[model samples]
Target: MDVTGLIPDFGNLAFTIVAFVVALSIIVFIHEYGHYIVGRWTGIKADVFSIGIGPVLLKRMDKHGTQWQIAAFPVGGYVKFRGDANAASAGVDEGAIAGLTPEERRATMPGAPVWARALTVAAGPVFNFVLSVIIFFGMAYYQGIATDPLTVKQMAPISGVENTLEPGDEILSIAGLPTPELAEFGAYVETLPDESPLDYTVLRDGAEVTVTTLHPYPAFVGSVTPQTAAADAGLERGDLILAVNGARTATFEDLRAFVGAGDGEPLTLTINRGGEEMDVELTPRRMDLPLPDGGFETRWLIGIGGGLIFEPATRAPSVGEAFTGGVEHVRYIITSSLSGLWHMITGAISSCNLRGPIGIAETSGAAASQGVPDFIWFIAVLSTAVGLLNLFPIPVLDGGHLVFHAYEAVVGRPPSDRAMRVLLAAGLAVVLAIMVLGITNDLFCP
Candidate 1:
């Protein structure tokens, strides 16, 4: 177990608490508001809209007689529809609507149409998804899509190369394909065999020229962290590792394998810097990195990041494209999450992949420390997870209600009150058990 896992720093702990609160509050508000607004639209009255649970901190009665309030806790929230037994809307309040007229009774949760109740319950998760999509679309719009008029700002140095590409050379085509953008060039590269020589059409000095270049996956340096062995040894951006300890490394993976095999020993490196060959020596440092399961593992590192084959170039996408990208992003997350869960169930992966509230709080703080954009992106990701989780076909979840609705539709009536009570209790137990398991993993996993 990592030392940080046993005891966290005070400053980090404070940030974690604050970030977790903010994230939870946003997600819960969006979820509860969905139920409240939809219920109102469906002609069912809502008695209260509350963020968090327990004692109310601030309350205001809307003109429509709905009590809006903020409560003491900030973990989760609920919306209490009128004439409901409790906030979960599990059953109806018979006494509350006993003497009301037909029109008045129809405006209460107990008297609303079956379809209206279903819609109201389903809205919570749907709204969470919508929030994620909107955030994703905003991120897409801000970053835009990468395009190409590919110009070489810098070239990775490779040893034994006689003809080096210049900085001003604009690559017009590769392998007989008219590469107008980086995306096309990347696709073309992916199709070709590694380390093979290819012909390229380049625009240099106001003229087009054809050149033959090897497609070797050199250890291209993308970044060097301060105070690291690589940085101290004078490695710079765009430098390429031609050989490690006199052995040629054709790919970044090869370099990693060699470094990781070392027992924190010094490494001999043959670097190619702008066609110039040089040698350097550096020792790998052991660093601990966080894991998804709320654990950490130490790894040998030179503090260098590699494998960026393109420059930063982006173009503004159309509104339609932005929305499509957002939807695709959410879909990707849901697909991957379900796939992971299935793999875990089959024992193909470790169960430690499950994270609890503590893990989420830790992640929230870490993301916040990175920057606002990073934190917002993290929030969007968490929102997507929340929405997807709520749709699991377990009792007490929105998906469970949906399943109940489907059953009622087929049988022409809801489940018996006793049956509903039993199912809800069972669901609550399963949910709590999962939470406990997650917390256990966070505390004891290695």
Candidate 2:
């Protein structure tokens, strides 16, 4: 068999692996560091703090006696506390504990108070969440929020349409309909006529002037989601959807309407990329989208986001506002994730939504290929998911350890060693089973 054709596929796979490793390593380091720092603060000594699993590739002993190391595997990491039998901290090292004095024993994880143990176990996920929040806050602050009065900052190029609106022009009305506040601009635009070359009344040079321009919301692509139908079809930002299956499309809504009406059938999209026309075919995927009111709606989607024809002027928001927005964004992701999981469980949505390592790696590569900002955003999102996953109350996870701590708190003792072993084994099985299911979906699902 000729092997030359496989070289490109191999190179792509390598890039995907590198991107996945980089993202996972950053998240794993932060999570493991959280456990290490909090355990130290609570007087629990760590024997080894490792990033990745398997044989150690590099190691260093700190003044505090913690062995900091990097291992061969780049998938996951852990902190082994004093008196821990293994990386998971499943049980005490009885011989090690017996050799230590009472004072030294107190510094061991098995010797620490239940409260301290619980706090250390919980810190990993909490730190992951904090990392996501910081990233979101920085991004929001850097990008700035859209300014009020809806002034045009810059005009976007549209194929076959002339734009007369200039930067610094404050839009007052479109097609004789008054423009609403910046928050309501989206809804306001939907109310406007779908026809192009609409009359725009704007305040320019301290004077109100009327000019003709394309519809504020045209069939323009502002963003394309990774691993979706559009991305699979090689769609990119700034590609205008001129027509759908030979039918002319005027606005983004027109494109959406056509896709919605297609009922998951293949679509022939006539695209205008930089004035060059081309046609591409793709089938719309059925997606369960989360709404603002904490519910979901199933819709046929191509996974491209649309925006107005002009970039809106923006103002730097106060730190408080930016932080609040960041927190809200994180909350939204968490709620949406939980809702999606629940829907999958209830058979309300496709189980294929549970992506495996392969899907995530592919997504990481796609996001990295887009640009640094998109890659960083993807890392933050993946970090949140990782943190949330570790918090599930399944054995062998941080949540399972927390649950055991809770039981100790109530029963005035930890579970029996045999019981602990049995529970840990069961938890590991559940985690492995989940991994298998995700991989199966990745391989077999459409």
Candidate 3:
């Protein structure tokens, strides 16, 4: 992804990585801070708190005895409680410290009130959601304050709906929710079902016109491919496929699955040719897709070019409108994330799309290619997802702790160690299983 005007001399890889680091640090801090402040307010002493896991790169101890450290891995962070299974392992000795004087004894994580512990854990995820909301609001307000043409001429090419939408197209609402930013317009399209109804209300020439069109996309497209049919087909950048075989595609995931099913046969394709649908034939060539475990398999892909396009809007949203729209965007994300999770658990959708860190990095890198605003939007959506997922009632998660707290409230004590250990073990298994599926999704499905 080259920035044509701004960074003609700079590489985007460096920028993407740096942007990822900055965004991660900010989000992680917000999440961890929720725990730190809540623990302190709840009369609990958090001895050490650090973001990320694995090896520590640097560290310092404050006068209050809290160790502030930066770890080599910056994906996420945690606060160590006074005690759990081991104290010495984490650089603190709970049993030995208890026998020392008040000044000499070390504060442990377990002695904190049960409610405090629960809140501390819960706060981390909560802050993630809060950060997403703030970022979303900023982007929304920025859009509202600036005006785009509100028509297809200046709209982005990847803008699934807005590009075709007219200047006077009244942006009544999206997915039953309202947003003022053109960026949010893409978000709404991303969430729509590939096969379901794609509905929208637009005001054309002062009349509310409903234009419900199918989403035209195949699958996730990216750089770094060694060799592929698309490369062989002479497909150039900025060429977006509006439809394939006459069926309008909305998402890449949609178009990809369709092409793969054709088994290397020539298929009719409708591309947005100079803002018009032009017919083309894509005969997918087979390529051996590498497997995660080292095996290789061939997959069919048509030689075609496609990508996202966002048109510059002539009209922007007002500050107040953008603020309101931002809030709604975050709320929509939170709700949609929870709903998607439910579907994942209930078998409504394929679990193959569930991703781990690899998926996140790939997504971040791809979004970064789209634009800075696109990357920021991706982070906000992911943050909402992280927050909602943490709320799942499973052991070792915030929601699980909350469940335990509720049980304590009723019974006046925590569960037995044997039971807690069993629960933790079960939770660990579930988490690992999810990881496996995530890796599978990344390699096999999408």
Candidate 4:
């Protein structure tokens, strides 16, 4: 056995470890602090508030006698309230409680009022949810709110329908249905049983024009490739390429054809944004792009991607709207996660979606490599996942503790200490099994 070879080669491994540690620490600290602060608010005394487990690497005592510590491990953390036997807050120290005065005894987890204990236990996940909402709100506020009457920006590259629509076409109705707004149009399109030829009524040249074609794709700009002519010309997501070289081009394919035919020549672009119009001058770059099937096609292009049929106008939203958006975003994440898990459990989807510490660490490193904002966004996502996981009704978790507390409330006394221990042990086993499965999937699943 080569003991010397047991140590990992540093280099990129070191960076990944650091990023993982930082991300985990932020999440763990906030979660534990939730318990600590809420416990204090409820008159519960916390003994040790630790981020991570095992041997302590750093420690400081607050004025209130709470020992806040950073431990050697960086994956998870906990809070040990006064008179608790361990970090999980599973068992109480009866002898320790007996030795203290009545007021001091009330400060321990077991001696605290049932409501206080439950509230303190619940606060951890609540805080996590709050953090997610706040982050989401900030993101929404920064991105601006999308409002609209559907206007075509770019179209799909499909051949037959390319000539039927124009980039500046304001979609008044489709398939004999009036779609006064982008959302309504999207709803109508999504409900279609199958792709069929449809009549599209659009406003162009100060008149209503009706055309028949299969609406293959949205005119929304999907992406703008960095360092490309589109980026240089200030073409952005949601910016509609209304007309190309003073000629009305309807579909995304039309925009592509015009740019391809430009052959590196400068072209005039009429752009519409939130009902405002402007002209831009850009020269297409000749470049080779890879086809999804295989090989490459050399073409003249201004780097841009188009999807989504309608260009929804955007404007700054009110604070209330931002808050509502934040809540909706969190609800969507939770609902989607639960749905995915349910599908996986029912064999409707692959269980390989489950990830372990290694997978998470690698993701953290990759996100950090992208940029600080991307990393922060990743952390927020991880925070939401972690919060959701902790709320599962498994033993040895905050949710499990609350479940026990609820039983005690109903039955007028806590479960026997021995019974508590057995349940905790079972819970530990279940949690460990899940961890093993996650890691196993990470290593072996393709």
- Residue 126 in candidate 4, Cα distance off native in Å: 0.9
Q: What's the TM-score of every candidate structure?
A: 0.74, 0.95, 0.62, 0.66
In candidate 3, which residue ranges exceed 4 Å CA deviation?
1-25, 83-108, 145-320
Instruction: Choose 3 or 4, whichever is better by lDDT.
Output: 4
Better by TM-score, candidate 4 or 1: 1
TM-score of 3: 0.62
State residue 283's C-alpha deviation in candidate 4, in Å: 34
Backbone clashes in each candidate structure, one number apiece? 1, 0, 43, 9
The 10-residue segment of model 4 with minimum total lDDT is 1-10
Alpha-carbon shift of residue 436 in model 4 (angstroms):
0.4
Off by over 4 Å in 1: 1-7, 151-181, 187-252, 255-310
What C-alpha lDDT do the candidate models reach, one value each? 0.78, 0.89, 0.61, 0.76
Write the residue-wise lDDT of candidate 1 on 1-446 in tens digits. 56464325787678889998998899989988999999999999999999989999999999988999999988899999889999988888999989999999989987887899889888988898899899999998887775567776544444444455566677776666666556555465555544435567889999999877645344767666533578557687667787889988766767888899986899998987877888989999775544455334568888788853433346788999999988988887777678677766776666776778877887787567656877888888888899889989888888888888888888988899999999999999989998999888777653
lDDT by residue for model 2 (333-401), tens: 899999889988898888888988978888898888888989999998998998899999998999999
RMSD of each: 7.4, 2.5, 10.6, 12.1
Query: Per-residue error at 165 for model 3, in Å?
Result: 15
